[model samples]
Target: MKITVLIENTKGELEDLINEHGLSLYIEKGNKRILFDTGKTNNFIVNAQKLGINLENIDVVVLSHGHADHGGGLLSFLKINNRAKIYMKRKVFGDYYSGNILFKKSIGINKEVFEKYSSRIEYIDNFTEIMEDVFIITDIQRNHKVPEGNKYLFVKEGTKIVNDKFEHELIMVIKENKGICMFSGCSHNGAVNMIEAVNKLFPGTSIKALIGGFHLAKIPAIDIFSTSQDEIDLIINKIVNEKIEKVYTGHCTGEKAYNKLKQGLGNKIEYIRTGSEVQI
Candidate 1:
C-alpha cells in the first residue's frame, strides 16, 4: 500500500500546491483508492490536481474527525466524488468551537452537507470494516493518561460550551502485506492511544508504521500547551517501547515536537508534508 499526501500544513516541492492549516491523504492499495480527511480549504482539490491525483475516482472517502483542519473540505470533495460513501462517526456534524469568546472559531463540518448527501455517508460509532482489510476504529478509549491534546477545543451544548469529548474521532487501519499501518487524523486521541487501539483491534499484528498528526507540537506564545515536553517524552518512549517502526507526522504536530521526536526516535520519525508519498 502507498499513501500520498494531498494536503498538509506546508508546501513541498510542488510549489503550486497551496498550504493550509489542515490534513488530507490519498491511500491506494490494490484496486482500492481511499481519500482520508480533506484539509480545511479547497487547497486539497487544487493540490491534488497538481499532483496528478483524480479526486473523482476515490473508492472511499473517510473523515478522520470533525475539526475544520480535518474535515472542512468535505463539500468540495463530495462534488468530485459525489456518489462515494464517506465514512465518519455520527457526531461529526455537531458544533465545535476553539479559544475564548473573544476569538472563538467554529471548527466542525457543515451539517448541511449531510442534508444534501445523507445517502453517501456511513456513520460508524463502533469498530467497522469498510472492506476486507480496511477498518475504522472509532470512539477511542482513553485507557491511559495521555489525553488527545485538544483541551482548548469545545463543543456547544445549548447555551454552554463544554469540553469536546472527541467522540466523533476515528482512525483508518489498513492491514498491509507485511503488517499494519494506522492513520489517525490529527491524533487528538494521542499517537500512543491510536496505535494501541489499532494493536488491540488486530491482535498480535505488529504495527509497522503510522501516519498523520500527533498534536504534540504547541504554540508556545499562546501557552496552549507549553508543558507538552513531558508528554512528548513519554509519548516517544511509548512509541519506541511499542516497536512502531516508522512514523510520518505533520499538521498539528508543531516543529518543536517533530524535532523532539527526531532527537529521540531519530530516523524513525518521517515527515508528512504536501506531495510526499509513503509506500509499504
Candidate 2:
C-alpha cells in the first residue's frame, strides 16, 4: 500500500504550501483509492493536483472527524469526485467549537459544505467497511483514563450544554499486504485509545504504521503548575506503550508535543509534511 500526506498542519519543504490547519492523505492499494481527510481548505485539491493524485478516481472518501481542519474541504472534493461514496459519522454535521473561538475559526465542518454533498454521504455510527480490507472505526467512546482535554467540547443548544458524546470522530484502518495502517485525524478521543481500539478489532495484527493528527496541542494555562510539555510527556508515554512502529504526525499534534514525542519515540516517529509519500 502507498500513503501520501497531501496536506498537513505544517510544510516541511521550503516549496511545500501550507494550508490552514488541516490533514489530508492519499492511500492506494491494489485497485482501491482512498482519500482519508479533506482538510480545512480547498487547497487539498490544489496540492493534490500537484502530486498527480486524481481526486476523481477516489473510490472511497473518509472523514476522520467533523473538525474543519479535517473535513472542511468535502464540498470541493465532492465536486471533483461526486461519484465517490463518503464515510463519516452523522454527528460530524453538528456544531463544534474551540473554547472562546468558534470552531470555524479554529476547525469545523461547515453545514453548507456537507449539504452540498448530502447525496453521497454515508453516515457510519458503528464500524463500516469500505472494502474487505478497509474499515472505519466508529462508536468510539473515550475508554481510557486520559483527560477529555477540557470542558470545551459539547453540543450547545443555543448556548446550553446538551448531552452529546461527540461519537462522530472516527479512525480509518487499512489491512494491506504489509499489515494494518491506522489513519486518524485529531484524535481527541486519545491517540492511544485509537490504537488500542484497532488492536482489539484486528487481534495480533501488528500496526504497520500510524499517521495523521493526534491533537496533543495543550498550551500552558495561566500559572499552571507544569508546562504543556509535562502534559505531552504523559501523552508520549502512552504512545510509547503502544509499541507502534512508525508514526507520521502533525497538525493538531502541536510542535511542542511533536518534539516531546520525537525525543521519546526517536526515529520511530516522523512528521507528515504537506507533500510527502510513505510506502508500506
Candidate 3:
C-alpha cells in the first residue's frame, strides 16, 4: 500500500500549494483508492491537483475523527467525488470547542455539510473492513503515560461543558506482507492506545509503520499546546521498543516533538509534507 499526503500543515518545494492546520491522505491499495481525511478548507483539492492525484477516483472516504481540521473538507470533496462511501464513528458530530474557556474555537465539522452528506455516511463503531485487510479500528484503550486528556478540548451537553471521550476517533490499519501500518487521524486518544488497539484486534501483528498526528508536536504559532518532554520520551520509547519501521508525522504532531523523536529514532522518523508519498 502507498499513501500520499494531499493536505497538511507544512509545504515543501511545492510552496505554491496552500497550507493549513489540517490533515488529508490519499491511500492506494490495489485498485481501490481511499481518502483518509479531508483537511481544512479546499487545500486538499489544490494539493492533490498539484500532485497529479485525481480526487474523483477515490472509492472510499474514511474519517479518523469528527474534528474540523480532519473532517472540514468533506463537503468540498463531495462536490468532486460524491460517490465514495464515508466511514466514521457515530460520535463525530456536535459542538466541539478546543481552546481555553476565554477563547473557545469551533473544532467540529461544518453542520451544513454534515447534514447534506448524511446520506452517504456509514457509522461504524465496531471493527470495519473496507476491502480485504484494510480496516477501520476503534475503541482504543490508552495504556501508556501521555496527556490524560486535552483540557482545552471539550463538548457541550445542554448547558454543561464536558470533556470529550473521543469515541468518535477511529484508526486505519492495513495488513501488509511484513506487518501492518497504522494510521491515526489525530492520535487525540493517544498513540500508545492506537497501537494497543491494533494489537488487541489482530494479536501478534507487527507494526510496520505509524503515520499521522502524534499530538505531541507543539505548534506555537497556532497556540496548540505541546506534550511534556517526559511524556514525549515515553511515546518515543514505546515506538522504538515496539520496532515500528517507519513514522511519518505532522499536522498536530508539533515540529519540536517530531525533532525530538528524530534524535532517538534517526531515519526511522520523518515529517510528511503536503505533497509527500509513503509506500509500505
Candidate 3 residue pairs that clash? 217-253, 217-254, 218-254
Ranking by TM-score: 3, 1, 2
lDDT tens digits, residues 1-280, model 1? 8899988877678777788788999988999989999988888899888888888888889998888778888888888776678999988888998776566778888777789989999999889899879999995767755444576688988898888878888989988877888888877777777778887888888788888887765531221344356777877898898888888888787666677778999999887878988888
Against the unseen true structure, what C-alpha lDDT does each candidate score?
A: 0.81, 0.75, 0.83
Give the candidate number with the greatest lDDT.
Answer: 3
lDDT per residue as tens, model 3, 130-168 = 778889987788676545436668888799877777778
The weakest ten consecutive residues by lDDT in model 3 span 217-226
Candidate that beats the other on TM-score, 1 or 3, i.e. the better one:
3
What would you estimate as the lDDT of candidate 2? 0.75
For every candidate, C-alpha RMSD to the true structure in Å = 2.0, 3.5, 1.7
lDDT by residue (1-280, candidate 2, tens digit) is: 8888878766757375655567888888899999998887899898888778888999998998777778878888877776789898888887776553344223457788666667788888777777888999885546764334433455655866543355668889988675788988877777767777888888888787888766665421111122256556665676677667788888777776677788888998888778877888
Evaluated against the true structure, the overall lDDT of model 1 is: 0.81
lDDT computed for candidate 3: 0.83
Off by over 4 Å in 1: 101-103, 147-149, 219-227
What local lDDT does model 2 show for residue 248? 84
lDDT of 3 at 136: 92
> For all candidates, what are the clash counts?
1, 2, 3
